[model samples]
Target chain A: MAIIKRYRALIILSIILLGLSLISPERGTQALSLTSASLIDMFSLLPPILVLVGLIDQWVDKQVLIKFMGDDSKFLGVIIALLLGGLAAGPLYIAFPIAITLLKKGANIRYVVFFLGVWTTAKLPIVLFEVAAFGWKYTLIHVSVGLIFFYLVGVFFEKRFDPNTLLKEDITSNE
Target chain B: MSQSIFLYGLIAILTGLSWFKDRQKTKKALMKAKNILVKLAPELLAILLFVGLSLSILTPETISSLIGERSGVIGVFIASFIGTFAMLPSFVVFPLADTLVSNGAGLVQVSAFIATLVSVGFASLPMERRIFGKEFTYMRNLSAMLMAFIFSFIIWVVLPWL
Candidate 1:
């Protein structure tokens, strides 16, 4: 019962898939195949990321992390955050665990937010692809505008929300 | 893919180093990884299902029709909305954007679609909320959506000049 309650959303989604399959077999099977493909992708990507996170959590000293990304780190913190985010691969979802782990290790909220912003918009491989698809001028404008906007958003969010309060649920809830 | 190979290589090196330093600590780290994987499995399944369903319903034809060149600001909004739900990889998304542009979608509309598609993840909100809490999740997504709109507007104005 507890497990079912915890997985209520997935259970509901599965039922919906089943109903859709009953209603239209072709589309339903297609959806199922897509889901399985994504699942395999997730499996391939997530384990290594999780392992890295776990290893970082265990090995990296809190003092060292704080010195680099802590509240007073400021400009240097932002630069480091951008580099980490820009170099990353995979989707926005992949960034969440890494972001939380950084927070857990005393990284400033603003830097963490900046990291997410960069991950979403300015990742290196994605930027290269964007340039190829949209032309250099368009990609330049998009990347610069997105980076500036997200930096401001990061600062704004840091001021608005207390890090301790924002991370409360994550700290307590094991997931 | 190359990314997977790179990731696996990195993990293997790190794991070996960690194990060499302290067997007990490495064991603990692996346990932590297992715990996260177990906890996240269900939410991940839900997210994948949502993506599959949305993609099936929002075919390329439907999207192109909704955001074709003459749709203007309304098209940008529609594109942004659709983007929030669709979560294809960046590699796939760029090509899809190119196809949409060739198929009559405006540059501004496609810009909105690509921007929001990469930045916002409504389908993965549950997982995000679980990690960062509700306020952070909502705020990040809303800000990303606003940024997408602004990006499209910039493109709409500037594309004419260039």
Candidate 2:
């Protein structure tokens, strides 16, 4: 029962796969193949990230993090957050674990939120791709608007929740 | 594949450096990484399955047809919703968006699609909720969706003036 509860989401997904197979075997097979490919993609990418996270956790001093990205760190904090996020090279899901790690290490909620925001908008490689596909005008509006808007959203989130209590739930907590 | 190779190489070099400095701390870091991977397996599996299911059903062809050139306001919402669910590669997404525009999809609709595609993730919600809790995840996604809309609106207003 405990195992079932823990694996319920995966089970539900399996059932959905089964249902799709029953309804449309072709689509089901496509989904299965795609899922497997992405699963491979994820497994490859995730380990180094987790290792990096763990190393950061064990090696970096919390006080140093707090000093750099803490509530009091102003202009420098924003630049670091932008650079850290904008230079990233992965999907948004990749940013979540990294963001949580920074939060756990005493970074300010505002910067953490802003970092996640910038990650979504301004990943450098993707930005270059966007400029090529959509022109500089379209790409510029997205980066500029995304930055200003998300920073304000960060401020809103900062006011809405306390930093220490923001992540009360453990990473494994599904409840 | 090359990205993975590069990352692993970087990890090897870094871990070697740290191991020389402090074997114990280095070991602890690897152990922590192991522990986190164990704990996160279920959520990761869920995300994998969801992405597979979503991608199969929400193919680029399906997305483009739903976002016709004359789709108007309803089309924008549909495009954003599709963007949130579909996890196309950034490389695939730009070209696809470019194709859609050339094939006559409206700029507003395509902009909404592009905005939410990068920022929002309805598909990754379980992993997000598992990590950041329910409220934070909801707030973040909602805010991202809002940003997507605002971005599309800006494109609609500004491009004409430009």
Candidate 3:
């Protein structure tokens, strides 16, 4: 868990770059050019946001978050997790820590999966970019269908995988 | 763009605060940044150059020929898998998908590929290992891939009617 947490940033950064590289060599170059600029751009948003997130991390503590996100009976936690996940911006790397934090706090596996699934699949900015690049029709088809698919996947994964345990294992191993 | 300026300013302030609070910690943080840059810059440049060469060398006809005609279910699957592996940004994929569609590519192929390109990927594995830890990242990606496949299938079936 310690190692996992420690190396998290490096891993996420590398994955993002890797994704860029696979886009044919020409697109890769453009990605590289954009990476630094994007980093600076992300930095602008991240620092302020991190300050807030960090504060939340510290203040909310793990127990409350867990309880808030863990309560499964009403599916309240699941809904909250999905909403947060759906609304989150940036890349998977940016989302991981927050997810981990929530996990430590006691968010359920279903919620985590929903959060993560949505976070990766749904982004208003990215959606807008897609729409602008493609067309409204394409964007509509993709997002509406994609959301339903993601939700179902989240539900399925939750049933199949023990997200809490997986996260717990990560944390314990890191420790 | 504006975000970059704000971030640089914030980082500057934070670094300054850390310096005043604890010089040693500040120095260590600076070293971490340097380390990341050192490891990152060369690889970034190399990848960019490689992409440039590949794009320049490969004819559009070749790309279209390879991806355009394969528009059936198999084609959609192939394109989505390839796109997932490729990871082209939405901006680039849009024009390319448009071109392919205009040329001869099926809507299913184009849509599926575009979705997969953004939503799922293997190229991101290394970074996923680093940031998300190996198991969690892989699981997440696997889930994404499965979902991408399903989404593409839905588009394949539905979009034509629309």
Index of the highest-DockQ prediction: 1
Q: Write model 1 residue lDDT over A5-57, tens digit each, in one string.
A: 76888888889889999999998999998888888777778899988888988
TM-score of chain B of each: 0.96, 0.92, 0.66
List the candidates ranked by TM-score, beginning with the highest: 1, 2, 3
- Model 2 misplaced stretches (Cα beyond 4 Å): A1-5, A170-175
Residue B139 displacement in candidate 3 (angstroms): 3.2
lDDT of 2 by residue, B1-162 (tens): 787898889988999999999999998888878877788788788888887898888766677788887898899999999888777656567888888887777889999998898888876787788778888889999999999999999998898887
Better of 2 and 3 by TM-score: 2
- TM-scores of all models? 0.95, 0.94, 0.65
Question: By summed lDDT, which 10 consecutive residues of candidate 2 chain B come out lowest?
Answer: B85-94
Error of 2 at B93 (Å): 2.3
TM-score, chain A only, candidate 1, equals 0.91
Residues B43-150, candidate 1, lDDT per residue (tens digit)?
788889987887777787889989999999899999999999888866688888988898888889999999999889977887888778888899999999999999
Report every candidate's CA lDDT.
0.87, 0.85, 0.58
Among incorrect, acceptable, medium and high, the docking class of model 1 is medium
